[model samples]
Target chain A: MNVLVQGVLLGGFYALLACGLSLMFGVMRIINLAHGDIAVIGAYLVWVLVNQTSMPPWLAALLVLPIMWVAGYVMYVLLLERSRRAGQLVPLLTTFGLAIVIENVLLQIFSPDDHSLLSSTGTLATSSISFGGLTISIFGMLTLATAVVVLIGLQFFLSRTTSGRQMRATAEDPDVAELVGINARAVYAKATAIAVAIAGLGGIFLAIRQTFNPSTGPTQLIFAFEAVVIGGFGSPWGTLLGGIVLGVAQVIGAQVNPQYFVLFGHLVFLAVLASPRGGLLSRRGRTV
Target chain B: MIRARGGQLSGGFRVQRWTRLSVVSAAVTVAVIVVLAVVPFLFGADVTEQLTSLLIFVILAVMWNALAGYGGLISVGQQAFIGLGAYGTIFLTQHGIAPYEAMILAGLGAGAVAVPTSLIMLRLRGGQFAIGMWVVAEVFGILVTLDAGLGGGTGISLNGLDVFAPGYRQAYTFWVTLACTTVLLGLVFFLLRRRIGTSLQAVLDDEEAAASLGVNVVRSKRVLFVVAAVGCGIAGALYLANTLFIQTTSVFGVQWTAYMLFMVLVGGLGTFEGPIIGAIIFYLIQAQFGDSGAWYFVGLGATAIAFALFLPHGIWGAVDRRLQLRLLPVGYTLRKLDTPASAGADPAATDT
Candidate 1:
């Protein structure tokens, strides 16, 4: 039962990382291979804000989120828009290039030293609450709550807001969306911005959870991918479910042997991928 | 039957398989191979080692091109096979097999692993397949790390090569590398000359259309995927032999994929000779600025991006467009019959 609770909390973190990826693919039809690197960059930004200005990590994250949002919009317009014109393969290669560039740039700046955001958070890093023969990290519970709230907010926005409708329209059919004066380009840019902002938030959560370095992006990428795949691609709610499943699998595997933690998660992902329905929750069947 | 400037024609045009230029190019390729085969005797171990690295790069670029360019199966997880081969080589060596023989067996072992992986991997398309492959590679690396016999994360070294003297080992490694590279290249070239080549090209152009037209898309893709895995595995095994050390981090690094992408993209995708040209250029650049560290990768990434966007066809494509040179032409071209009357006309008129 304790393991299940911990797994659920871990799943929340994975969901936070993956929802942005789901959103980007939902709208743009392109998987940002550099998604994790962008998140890493956001983490570094927050790190610098906390260290250099001596500001609180939460406040630094708030400042960096808006910056990431704007950067995502500009990046979509400048880099992806043009590269996507060439062909399907080019855009993927472009994102890969971006990933390499971002990772190496981080290495160049940070010198490959491991940094943890929790180091600056005093007792908040280790503080936990006990209930019914179970103990949970305060940060972990907070992350789960935050993930739930964010997903609820996103669900609301997608259903109710005008901008969200426009994003949906574009995602459904860009040509038709443009025909209806929805400004699909603008909608895509908006979607990118939202996705990137959320990715930044995920990065902050990741940094608080564990130590990170420049090369850490790819591993994060695989985890997010596993979550997205496990949840079923192109579905936001599915991402959450997928994350939880992955987290649970990982936790259970770790119980057997510590070395099996990541291996177990990966095996579960592969099993899901090999499944006839593509995912446990996906009714659409074999999207990838 | 009409006689064109080059060959006999069934109609007004002739379907030419080989041009005068192609014949010359083939001769030059043979001459170069002869020279390369004799490099161990002509130079020291350093030069032989450098040439071996070049051969491995060429092998990687060619294999990647065969998969991505011709088969439209862009995979970023090829390092899984490389790491497997490296460890497999060490495993075989520990089992009392000769290191040289172990490398070859390891490559085959990687190909065997690729068979099952392609079933799962081929289900994905475009970006999903690319990242899916990466996931596979990560899983393989973690699995290796779990095994203590493989040295966990640090990895192991091939230990059976001490019987041969240093110079003889160097010469033997060079010869094996040369033979492997040549055979692989020949296999790709031979495949391209067969009817399966056209089916692959059709698949690359459009999968559904090719499928509707009766092409075995999955089989062709599987063939290429398995072949590429074997090629990368051999490269990995050779790397271990050359350095006498194999590590999880080094063998399974994504840098190998990046190199493959750079070579294939910069050379010209879908062209037989493009990867060779790209590999040579990459070798030159690495020789010059390899020590620049992160900046070097940044530069490489940037260059690959630039080529992917602005120069999608790459350097060879530009040259091929202007010169109409197919140094190793696999596809047939139809040319108008150039009779004595049309000989004095514009040279462009000779090609229909």
Candidate 2:
């Protein structure tokens, strides 16, 4: 039960990691293999805020969100606008290139070392509550709560807000949306920005949970990939569910053999693929 | 493999004789093979070894080109077969089989392995398909490391090659590599000239439309995947033959897959000569500047970004447009006669 509870908490964080990746895929149909590498940039942004100012984590995280959002927008204008250019930057090609550049950038700046973000709010991460013999970290709760709130906010933004509907409309029919006077490029840019904004939040969670170095970012992309695949592409709630399952698998695997944590996650990942219907959760719609 | 269907080159005048130009081409190939075969005795042993490795990479790149450019299946995990092929040959040699025999086994073994990987992984489409295959390659790497029979962290070594003389072994490896690369290039060219290759192009252009056209999409793709793996397997065996060793990191080095993909992409994938051209250029670049480490990757990354952003067609694609010459023509085009002789001369003559 304790393992299960802890697993669930860890899953919450994985869900957070996956949401941005899934969202990007949903709207733009871009893999953004550089997604986690971009998150690494966000992590460093918070690192700078925390180290130079020694600011609290939450405050630093909050401060960096707008900046990260802008970075996301710039990335959109520069990278995502040209679909042909986007295609040329296939996962193995351009994303691999981005990984090298970002990792090296972090390495050069941070000197290939691990850095930490001290608690932003007093004991925010350390604080925990006990329930039924399982002690749950408050930051874990924070992560879970953040996921729900942000998801709900995102959902509301997508379904109710004018820009959100424009996003959906553009994703559905970019040419048609352009005909109607909605800027398809801006919609893509906005959706990409929202994805990166969530990634910034994920970066904070990453710093809180583990010691990170420059090269540690790509694995986040891998983990998110597994979650997204399991969740079915473009489904937000499914991404959350996929994250939790991956988290539980990792924890349980480590319990069996600590070295097996990654392998265990991969096993479950393969199992998900081995299933007769891969990405079983995506509600089949008419192909665009 | 170029497989032309339904049309004999309508007899033209002197120009139509291009089909018989194979005599000149095959002569040159034979001459090159003869030189390469004797080169161990002619050139210093060190250069021979380096050239052998280059040949191995060239073959692997060609295989990658076939899979990506011709078949339209972009797999980022091809290193799985490469590592498996290298290991397969090593294991066979450990059991006292000859090196050449081991290479044949490796080709078949690679196809065998691709079967399950394809069944499990080919289901993924688009970017997900590509990434999923890459992770699966990592899984194979991990599995190999855990297996004690394969020497765990310290991988098993190829032993039976000691039966051959050292110079003989190096020379033999070089010849085999050259021969394999030639055969692979030939096979790819032959396929591209066929109906099956056209089906592949159709699939790449539009999967569903190809299906609607009565193409047996899945089987054709799987067969090409298996064939590509076999070619890669041959390259892997030759690689081990040159080095006489294997390790998980060195054998299944993820970077090798990246290297092959870059060769195909930067050289204008789908063009037979493109990968060959890319591999040579890549070798020159790496030999000259690869020691820069992370900076080398940075430069490579920048190059990829530049190409992806600006020159998606690559060097060959550009040259193809400007010159309109195809040494390995995968698609067809209409042409006009240049001479009055074309009106009544040998109909195939106009094809030239």
Candidate 3:
């Protein structure tokens, strides 16, 4: 029971990390292989902000969000925007190559080393609550709470905001969106930026929890991929469930033998692949 | 139809068509090999060794072309089997089999491994197939990396291979690579001409339509998958012979996949002439700026993006379309469709 409880809390962080990725993938149909790397870049940004500005983590993240948004937008314009019209192979290979370049560049600049940020007392990320015998870490709990909150906000934004409806419309059919006078390009740009900003926050939370380096991106990317695959492609709520499953799997595997951490993750991925549809999530949501 | 297209050649190069091109290509390839064969005697040990490296690269590129271009499999994971083949050869030679003999055997073994591996994986289609192959490669890398005797992460050396004396090794490596390339290319042409080739081409054009035509899509794909594994296996053995070792990082390097994709795509996909053209062009790119680090990969990516967008037919694809060149001679040629009737005056003469 304790293991399940602790695992569920940790699963919340995975949900946070995976949501931004799945959202971007959900809307754009682009994998954005640069996703984890971009997140790492955000982590570094938060690191600099904290060290340089004496700002709180939450406030510093607000400062970092626009920068990440621009970075994502620029990356989209220069790399991903036109890629939409290209064949499937084009986006897959180009993004992979871009991932390699970004990771290596980060390595060269940061020296393949790992670092973390110094947070103040009661930051909620590191604090935990103990009720009865099972103890829930505060940061893990906060990340979970934040995930639910942000998801609800995103759901509201998508449902209530005109821009969000435009995004959903473009995602459904780019050609049709053009007929309705919605600029598909602008929609894609905004969605990518939003997804990237979420990724930024997710990365910061991740860095707070673990020791990360440039090489860390691949594993996290794979984890998010598993969530996206298992959750199905387009459902944010499904992604949360998927993240919890992956998180619990890891925790349970660690209980048996820590040596099998990666192997377990891979096994789950293989199972996901073996499913009838391969992707558990549907491409769209509706009664039809 | 054959005569009509053959007649367009006013020069000797086109005079005999198949017979002449075969004779000419064989002559040119042999000439090049023979000259490179004696390079150790002409220049020095170092240059001979470098030439061997280039030949090994050419073999790898051509193998990638078979899987990607001919089969339309587009695997970014040839390194999976390449790494397996290298370690297989290294482990075999450690027990006293001659490296050359083991290299051939290793290729056969890898082909045997490939058929079933591809069967399990063939369920995946398109982007799923592409990423699945990479995932499979990572699995192989991890499993191999856990082996203690194979040196694990530290890797193993070809001190295990005692096939030839040190003095003659590099030159021998060069000849073996050339021979492998020749044989692989020969096998490619043979496969392409078979009924199997037609079926495979049909599948590439449209899977459902091909299946409806009674093409055994599964068998064709499996055979090509196995053959490509054999080709990659031999290339891996050759790479080991040249470098004299198999480090986990080097043998399983993603760079091999990158280079292979770069060569095949940049040169051309789905055409025989493309991979070869790509290898030469890639060699030139490496010679010029390979030492510049990740920028070259970025540039390669940019080039692939440009080709995928505008020139998706690839360099050879472009040249083949624009200039009507079929240097590799894999596909059969018919007379021009617009050509007015000549001696036969048959309307079907213009049919492709």
Top candidate, metric DockQ = 1
lDDT of 2 by residue, A1-288 (tens): 877777788878888888788787777777777777777787888888887898777788899899989988987787667643345335445666666677777777787777766444467767889987888888888888888788778888888989988888887888899999999878888888988989988987888777788877767888888888877677778787888888888899889977678788888888888887676476675111
Candidate 1 runs further than 4 Å off: A285-288, B1-13, B336-352
Candidate 2 residues lying further than 4 Å off, grouped into runs, are A84-92, A111-128, A286-288, B1-30, B94-100, B154-156, B162-166, B339-352
Model 1 local distance difference test score: 0.86
lDDT of 3 at A269: 65
> What does candidate 3's lDDT look like per residue over A189-216, in tens digits?
8888888888888888877787778767
Chain A TM-score values, per prediction: 0.97, 0.94, 0.92
TM-scores for every candidate against the unseen true structure: 0.95, 0.90, 0.85
Query: Which pairs clash in model 3?
Result: A125-A139, A127-A138, A128-A138, A232-A281, B69-B270
lDDT of each prediction vs. the true structure? Answer: 0.86, 0.76, 0.73
- Give the C-alpha miss distance for residue B284 in model 2, angstroms: 0.7
How do the residues A1-288 of candidate 1 rate in per-residue lDDT, one tens digit apiece? 989998999999999988888888878778888999988988899999999999999899899999999999998897788876677777788888899999999999999999988878888778999998999989988888888888888888887999888888777788998998999878878888988899889999888888899998888888898999898886767888999999999999999998889989999999999988787777653221
Give the docking tier of candidate 1: medium
Output the number of the TM-score-best candidate: 1
